[model samples]
Target: MGMKDKFQDQAGQRQQQANDKTGESREKAGQRSSQQRERSSQQRDRARQDIDDTRDEMEDRFNQDYDA
Candidate 1:
């Protein structure tokens, strides 16, 4: 091939490689974000559950003391 053609081919290959790397990086970032969101949701749910349990325990103690 001519020099010009060879140069063009190399440039095209480099562009494709860059595009592929960009795509992979984006995919990994998306996955990490999704995982973080899921963990946050779980933590919130657990905190709510703990609050409910504590409230119930306090109510039970008050009721028993009043009865006695």
Candidate 2:
């Protein structure tokens, strides 16, 4: 595959892995105490934000590469 396709594939894989980790974290946090649960919830939000940022960066890179 070309560099663009390779980058797209890697981005998709990273997104899927992030989603899986977030789901697992949420499931485990369900059994935590109130304070711990709150902490885990915050962690989940951070993870989501990280995923969004990565996705946006990947899209920007992909666009730049393809537009060239």
Candidate 3:
């Protein structure tokens, strides 16, 4: 092949390699973001449940005091 054709081929190959790396990085970033969201959701649910339980316990104590 001529020098121009060879140069063009090399440039194409480099572009393809760079594109592949970018795609992989994007996929990994998406996965990490998804996992973080799931973990935050779980923590929020647990906190809500804890607050509800505390409220119920306090109500029970107040009722007992009134009965006495």
Candidate 3 lDDT, 20-63, residue by residue in tens: 99999999999999999999999999999999999999999999
Q: Which ten residues in a row have the lowest lDDT in candidate 1?
A: 59-68
Which run of 10 residues does model 2 get worst, by summed lDDT?
Answer: 28-37
lDDT per residue as tens, model 1, 16-48: 999999999999999999999999999999999
Ranking by TM-score: 1, 3, 2
Over 4 Å off, model 1: none
Model 1 TM-score on a 0 to 1 scale:
0.90
Worst 10 residues of 3 by lDDT: 59-68
In lDDT terms, how accurate is model 3?
1.00
Instruction: Pick the TM-score winner.
Output: 1
* lDDT, each prediction: 1.00, 0.94, 1.00
What's each prediction's clash count? 0, 0, 0
Model 3: how far residue 22 lies from native, Å? 1.2
Better of 1 and 2 by lDDT: 1
